[model samples]
Target chain A: MSEELAAVEETARRRGSRPIVWLAWFLLAFFFVNLAGIVFSAVVDSFGDNWFGNWLPQVWTTHYWSDAWHAYDLGQVLQVTLIVSVAVVIVSVLVGVPASYALARRNFPFKHAIMLVFLLPVMVPPIAYGIPLATAMYKFNTITHVQIANSMFGVILANLVPAIPFVVLTMTPFIEQIDPKVESAARMCGASTRKIFTRILLPLLVPGVLAASILVLVRTVGMFELTYLTAGTDSETLVVKLFDSISGAGIRAPQQSDAMAVLYMGMMLVLLVIALRFVNPTQLVTRVAEERDA
Target chain B: MTVAPPAPAPARRHRPPDPRAHLSHRLAERGIDRTLWLLLPGVVFLVALFIYPLAYGLGLSFQPLKSTDPLYNYKQFFTDHLQRDTIGTTLRISLPAALVNVIASVPIAYRMRGRMRGKRFITTMLVIPITLGTVLTADGMLKFFDPAGGWFNKTLFALHIRTPDQPVLLINNYWGVVISLIISGFPFAFLLILSYLSGIDPSLDAAASTLGASPRRRFWQITFPLLAPGLAITFCLTFVLAFSVFPSAYLVGNPTSTTRVISIAAYEARSVETNDSKASTIALIMAVIELLVISVVLFGRGRLYRGSTGGKG
Candidate 1:
């Protein structure tokens, strides 16, 4: 009697757990299908000559790709994008690396408060400050005639607002993990400060610097709101231009817009792939949060 | 080598009373800290670009349009229907989308909790939408969810769920916006929850099972309680992301009023209406709402995880 009851209980437990296991697999499958479907649909539509009420496009061509390229003036857009991204990366690293070193090594007054100040730009959405930043830029340009607003300089400056802080936060951990005694030892060997920084510290810090710069590059490319608000007709990045192509009150074909999207996606995918090689996405979130809390 | 060093020191001591030495001595006397100087460049940059602008925006929001009523913009934000609906519209979409994403991710994450094959692959796939961003996702949604000849309607027609004439209205509506938000928001929420779940020890469940507890009871009694704080935090972060919806709302939904979130309202007030003060008012209100929600979630999390060891066992 006892054996029979145990068997029956075992069977019931299996029955109860079977659906959950099936559900997990189903959810996984659903996630793949949904993500793949969205991405593939865009790619296919971009090349499709005509796709109406069909599982596949009736015809495919590369015509829209060229059309989007010239019609959107993508050459200029891409040039501006590269220029802005590179400038933001270089300036942020120059400004952030030393600050990160200081933050890692020093005990200072109002350190937590200062850290929170850096955190604000990142934690808060860009739109919160973007309006006023744009306004100030416009005001500055009108007053000084320096033309920072609606220019490439303005866009780079705007991108740097978040980029610098991100670099500081990410590089602080990298700097912290290194032993400070190494630097002191280099100094004790009668090396000048510049030699210590250039010869010893730079080599050890290369991996972290590379990771931070790659992330900054990715962010500058993907940043939308600030660029959208600040970019002029001549200075729009890929993302801002893509937004214009979609809603710019022009009578462009949807396929052409899809093509532009595909281009944007291509650029982002390459950068993201590179970034993932250096940093885990899970660790990325935790690092950002941990810095804010600390 | 040591004799050469001593000869260099003699030359420096006799080098016409070095001006740089006096300057260095003065600087040292004034307590010119190197670390402070090192931090100055970044500090100046952030203050000039970030802090000044945020403060200016707040100050601008309080300025009166007529120079008579100091509270003009604030009053307008509350009294004006169009401005006021933005708050309601933003909340209506953001709250439900965030809640749905959090709730839906729980069961899926719970099921995938233990060591499983392809977990990394699954996570990578999930992160694709986030990388794609809102612009790409909305663009794809426009094509996929088209009513007349889109894949979605075609599938529905073939499935006999709806006739050709009665195609479902998926895009340019409230549900369409909500669905798009979910598509983008779910991946992030799922990643957070999965990471949280991984931090939980598996032995608790094993112990519970050995004690004759069923799987369902083990989950509810042991796992769910421990997961509450993580759930609260995940929901708060995702909620902030959803609340700031701008591109998707504009691209896929009825942005005039139904899906006109506060970001849109601020954009219009500043760009279309060219009213910086009103835009600042809207932006500040949005920030306040986000902060309030986050604080509430944190407080609740403190209560939930107050003495619990988070199952480090």
Candidate 2:
């Protein structure tokens, strides 16, 4: 009786879902087509000599890429970007992984409050917190005579605000998924806490840590507001440089901006591909939803 | 006699040292074991970098640089039409964009909820915008929606909906920022909603269907209510994202008038005008508004079914 009912329901579902499925496909295609068109337009413009009212540029050239690289001082920008992203990734992972273990494994007082504190940066938009953060950075610079507000150190510090929390958020689920029995087994075998962490947990946590670090690295690379607020002239990252080229008061060619944009997109795409290779697309956000519910 | 009595008492079995006597044991009792030392660096980092600065900024907002009145910055912001109107403009752009993104994401996320063959490919494709970030998306929008040769205008030209002379007014307008927000925000909303939708057990729907409920009826009766809380959260997240839009507004919208959002106003106050106090005040206002919206949505979520919908996250 249940089998017959299930069969009937399955047929009805398949029949009823056709239009809805088509609509879903249409929406997906529409979205991707627009996305591709947007990226394609930038790519073509970056290589094109001039674009007018036409389907494609009449001429194509690589000069814009060369021009943008030199004109924007992209070598220095890329160097700064690399330094900041790497520093942020290392620091966030180092700070976040153990904290994730604590949060995941221990039932502690004010656990929810602590989680909220960690989640605040991820939940709040950057500018909401960034303004105050930048102000404090500038103030610190004046008081301590340290170049924190606009220096590379300042940029790393500001980016860490979000990056560290992101690491914690991503790593918590990974830690939770590891069975507590394994740790207990090691403990019963006379492993000290330090040995348990260094020998057992560390090995188990490699993939999670790598995924977290790569995600943080990508986030740091693209972080604009905090970087914009805190970075000095010499500390600007690629995204910030890209923004300045677009919005700054200067007589710059459109193609040069397009070229820089294409370069920025390429770097982000590379990081994203690497990130997605290790981390499932769903894994990126599911943990966050779980965190919210918890 | 006293000595004999003491000896006799000493013969009683000695209690093993109380486990709680050790600091580690006591801390463990309170859920603050040695393992918690690992949390120290992150907690300290956040306190110094995130919490302290925000607190300092709040304090700074109360200290006007040029005015004796503590409320001077706040007053000036409210009194100034340009600055005050930004609250409205930001809302105008963000509210609808967030709503649209959340609404658009739900149907698609529902359709794509369970195991599907191309789910991974589709999800990865949707995630492109999120990775693209705002600046690139704005650049893309500029070129793709350019009046002279943008593909959008070109499409309009092909469709005869518009001509080269009068392309769809997408870039550097109110709508442009909203569109950019939707494009960047929809992917996030979809990912979030999909995760939430997948959290609901399929058996409930199957049960509903077995009782002879139609697909539409089952969705409204069972799935929609279950999804309400997640939708509220998705809305709040997207709203916050759109509300704090800066790069897109600067790159794609009319910054001075049409879409001079609160963040841009705060930026100008801090950077352009070099008034940190005023910037902090505006930043506080922005945070307040965002919290207000979030709390309202969450309050609505509280009214929904509070029990677990069955699938563990």
Candidate 3:
């Protein structure tokens, strides 16, 4: 009798969870289907001759892709993107890693205040600060004749505002996870500070640095507001190019715009794939959330 | 090759020790060592690029080009109907979208919190939007959700949800921005809430179940209270992101009027009108509004939960 009752309870529990499990799956399916459809449509529309009011384009061609490439000067745009992304990655890591080591391994007066200053750029959206930054850059250009605004140099600097803080935030937790005894052991071996950092810490920090780099690379590519505010004609990245193509009143087919967008999306997807290989997406959010809780 | 030191060095000791080395020793005692110098470059960069610009902009806002009044820019923003109504328009779009994103993610995240098959696959799929960003999403959304010939309408028509004569007009209107926000913001809220949910002890839920509490009861009575603080933070962050809706409002929605968020106002003021003072004023206003909303949520969160829900985690 007891066995039958327990069996009945088991069935009841399963039945209770059945609808929720189904609902979860249904939502996931719904979201992915829409996402896939959205992305796929861009690809299909770019190649379509004149797709209108149909499930599939009646005709397709690669002409738009070529047209967009030349019309948008995408070759230069892509090169600028690569340059900006790579520069931001290297510079941010170089500047941020040592700061992260100091922040993680020591206690100092106003540490939290310093951290809040670093955190502000990441927490606040770019548009809030980008306006001021761009305005200041322009003013500086007029006064100092340095020409930072509306130039490639300006774009790199604007991108770095958030990127450096992000690197520090991500790397701090990674440094904390390493045992301090490792550093002590190096010290015991009579290794100087610089030598310990170069010989001991750098080798152990490769995975963390790689993860931070890829994440920053992906962000800098997609960064729009700051770059848009600061970039000049010659300095525009692929994303800025795509935006101009869309909002521009140029007499080009919509398919051309779609083609440019596809190229941008393709680049982003590749970078994302590489980033995911080295980092667990959840691990990134966990640290930030834990910090908030503390 | 050892050399003996000079006898006692008493005469040299009359002068103060090297001032630089003495200062360094004091600084190091306070946890500022050579390693701390590494923080200098980043701090200098931020101050130069972020803080100084913002300060300059703030000062500039007070000195509008045409008006002598220090408050003229602020006055103009509040007085002009076109500019003033944007506060309402922005909130109308951001609030519902953020609320829906946070509220919807709670249940889904709750169910998916435990170890499960294909977890990484689903998490990665959700996180893809963060990297895809507003630009790509907006571009794709314009094509995918186009009323005239988009797949969404096609699907609706095929499913008999609506007649072919009447397709859903999602794009180029208010609903378009909301949908775009949900698409991008939902994943972020999900990721944040999932982390918070996973931090809770599972034993509490098991104990509740053992006590014969129904699943629904256990969630509402136990988990919901514990999860409130996290939900507040997730909502606040998501709300902030949603409030700064610029690219989507431009690309997917009607940016001229229906989806004219404050960011658009600031953008037009700076880029179109070339009025740096006016633009700075609007940007400051946007930041103030965001801070107000955030502080209110956080204050309520403080009242809602005073202490941590104890757990091994």
Top DockQ hit: 2
Write candidate 2's Cα lDDT for A1-294 as tens digits. Answer: 387877787688778778887887798788888889999998999999757878899998999899998999999999999999999999999999889989998988899988998988987879989999988988888999978888999999999999989999888988898899999999999999889989998898988888888888877888899999999999999999999988873578888999999989989889889988877776665553222232
- Stretches of candidate 2 off by over 4 Å are A1-7, A17-19, A288-294, B1-24
User: Which CAPRI level is candidate 3?
Assistant: acceptable
* DockQ of each model vs. true complex: 0.33, 0.59, 0.49
Q: What proportion of the true contacts does each candidate reproduce?
A: 0.45, 0.71, 0.65
Clashing pairs in 1: none
Ten-residue segment with the worst summed lDDT in candidate 1 chain B? Answer: B6-15
TM-score of each: 0.86, 0.93, 0.91
The RMSD of every model to the true structure, in order and in angstroms, is: 8.9, 6.6, 7.5
- Among these predictions, the greatest lDDT belongs to 2
lDDT of 2 by residue, B1-313 (tens): 3554443455535555467597776666677887788888999999999999889988999899999999999999999999999999989999999999998888899888877788889889877788889999999999898887789889989999877787788899998899899888999999999988888988899988878898888889999999899899889889988988999999999999999999999999988899999999999899888888889889999999877877764
Best by TM-score: 2
Query: What lDDT does each candidate get?
Result: 0.82, 0.88, 0.86
- Runs of candidate 1 exceeding 4 Å displacement: A1-18, A179-196, A288-294, B1-33, B203-214, B306-313
For candidate 3, write residues B122-216 as lDDT tens digits: 89988888777887787788889887789998889889898878889888899989988988899889988888787787667766766788877
